[model samples]
Target: MTRATASGKQRRATLLGVLGVFTVHALLLVSRAAWAQEVGTVAEVEGTAEIGRGGRWSPASVGTAVQFKDALRTGHPGRVRVVFQDDTVLNIGDDSHLVLDEQVFDPAQGTYRSVIHMIKGRVRALVSEYYKQPHARYHIDTPTAVSGVRGTEFIVSYDAATEVTEVVGITGRVEVTSPLDPTHHGVFVTAQEITSVARGKFATPPTRLSDTIFRQYLKGLEFIGGGHAESLSAASPLLTGSAIPRSDRSAAFEPPAAVAGAAPGGRPNASHDASDLLHQPPGIVRALQNGNGDLGVRF
Candidate 1:
């Protein structure tokens, strides 16, 4: 061909090559966005942990993609931490068996939901405040009861032998109710409070826990093998007593208000001041000022 024709062909070839590169990059971007739809990532794993589906298991490690319906189990001295897209964190304790029953995060529609089926053992969760948004639901279901939360840091434990489920609220709130109850009546557990639901029974009223007992429960979730046990220092929110907003909804059974009684000289009784423990739980208020200090109030 003539020189002019050859030059024209060369120009067209270069244009096509650039277009092909652009197309490939676009496709890669789309692929990555789709892959990110998976529920969460295994942020940390220690000792013997397995994740699987359909009863077949494989060893889990950091960066493992946790998907819908995925089952996770932790053997002796094992622990797994999962971080979700919405900033919720879950630390599964040793000897735990759980399934990610349902998880959906769609920012376009402003919808978020997560449901964990805890067959046994413990899961310490720092749930995201996004769960309080409209059309959001977060729940941990056990054989005996369902522990639901809008946003909170909490620990859930279920005992297979006793068929009992217990929930301890560390920061925000957790609502524990019996699955068998149609009326959905349950107690609202606030920060530093705890409740339990036994087989065929409703959730018990939330009881305030002292700082000593609360710290002991948190120590149980530390990764012993990873040397992360010291992570629960005074700076930690659980220990420092950082306050999260309380749930706007009321519980089926709110703690009784401060009982009115005569002290003397037409004044309210001093004993009545301690009655409203639900709003001002002892440890939390005290810890906010002095880390790990004694809460002067006795439950």
Candidate 2:
């Protein structure tokens, strides 16, 4: 071939090689994205859970965490609610650390599995129909215990101070055990039962919180909404040490003015939401009253 023709042929070959490389790179990116979407997704955030930096969740702040067949990344000192593709709901409380252990969905084999490792703090989970599958397994692990869950609503709290693990079942059932003890394992706990496990021994019949206390907890849900720091601060003095009379509890439902911005009627903003002030749980609330402000110790 002539020299000019040879040069043109080399250029065409070089262009084809570049195009091939680009095609491969694009495919790799798409594969990664698809895998991530299959992992799990973040459904919502009630109050403040830091996302990137300086992002806080308030009454006005609602965010979603979405993970597809991959791990959902997070930072410290935040609360998040995640819904896996398998229709499982996982609520992560503040100061807690977790990672998606495994995610597999296969209809042919009738296998659907979800696993998470709780590195620290508290987590509440609600499992759905996926648990009915004989082959399905859902688990959450802490330093002291492993919770085997099958279609249930439950709360797990890890208190590093006492080195104690507490599990409360709202619905369905759960089996709690120490990985070290295989033979000495205990019985399954049903709804409305709170199980405490420590030193490889399970407590006999979990302590039951009174209906009044439990009702207060349900009312505390309103505190999850942001915008009430100042009002809560002002009322903190009078409400201190005094049992929040059941009658006044309904009035406490009002969101703090600083956090809520304005009242529904012509009333002025009076208080702040509990979320904005205290990031810890009920256990830590008492500690805070005792003049302790360390979250690490409380968690």
Candidate 3:
């Protein structure tokens, strides 16, 4: 073989080796980032927190990347709040064991499926408004019941010994159903409402949660970082506190009675003048319905 030709072949082989290494490294980086993207951040932590992944337990602190299949546990004096990709926050109270069973968020397509397994203890969540942008949904699997919602805030606490799951609604509504009673459709607990699910049975119908009890549950569970007041910004423009007024918790869920010529939905007539939209609108008929419009004052 010609010496020059052999040398050219050798150089080509060397070039191919360099390109192969570059491609492999590039792929490795992509995979690593993808793995990290499937995780959430520990926004705030108090006392002691630990995470179990791959059957190994490790101490956890703020900013821990809590990934799917990782179980987070907090001691008696511990609490942790995890912020998901779309800024949804789950505040876990002490003596709690939570497993991130599934989490997928795709903003461009507006699709999300968040599922968590609560082995025991309590968790308060502010579901992102983007949750229902397309096919978004969230679920919490407790020992006694499974709770689901689209975008709202609620709390779930389970007692392993009693096999009971207590669910309370702070802002949005929650529906709880026992796995054992698959056919039973559960009740929807609205703001300031509370309910319980017993072992092998569906949830009890929701009842009003007294203001005193509701305030007690909120003791340490609040958004700590990222502008605490904007906790529900991702859900809607209204402040989280105003979702249900103290005087009218049930009014938030019940549809307004229809005035004579009103459209199917209770919204002010589309043709109405903007000035009168809040109270009276053209073609809304004689009876003025939906008291105040204060319930939904926009941001």
Native-referenced Cα lDDT, model 1? 0.67
**Candidate 1 Cα errors over 4 Å, as ranges:** 1-37, 223-299
| lDDT ranking of the models | 1, 3, 2
Task: State each model's CA lDDT, in order.
Answer: 0.67, 0.51, 0.63
Q: Against the hidden true structure, what lDDT does model 3 obtain?
A: 0.63
lDDT of 3 at 269: 23
Residues 149-229 of candidate 3: C-alpha lDDT, one tens digit per residue: 878888898999898999888777787888977457778889888889988777888988787888777666655433243
TM-score, candidate 3, is 0.63
Tens-place lDDT digits, model 2, residues 1-299: 99999999999999999999999987665554433332333334544543221222212122222332222323353556554545565666766556566555554456666767666667767676668778788888777777888887677777777768877766788888876773366557666677777755654466667766544333322122332211123234222434333233222123222222222222322322223222222222344455555321111
TM-score of each: 0.63, 0.54, 0.63
Give the Cα error of residue 58 in candidate 1, in Å. 0.7
* Pairwise lDDT winner, candidates 1 and 3: 1
Could you tell me how far off, in angstroms, the CA of residue 42 lies in candidate 2 after the best superposition?
2.0
Candidate 1 residue-wise lDDT, 55-122, digit = tens: 57878765455655668999997888765655576888889999987666655556677889999999
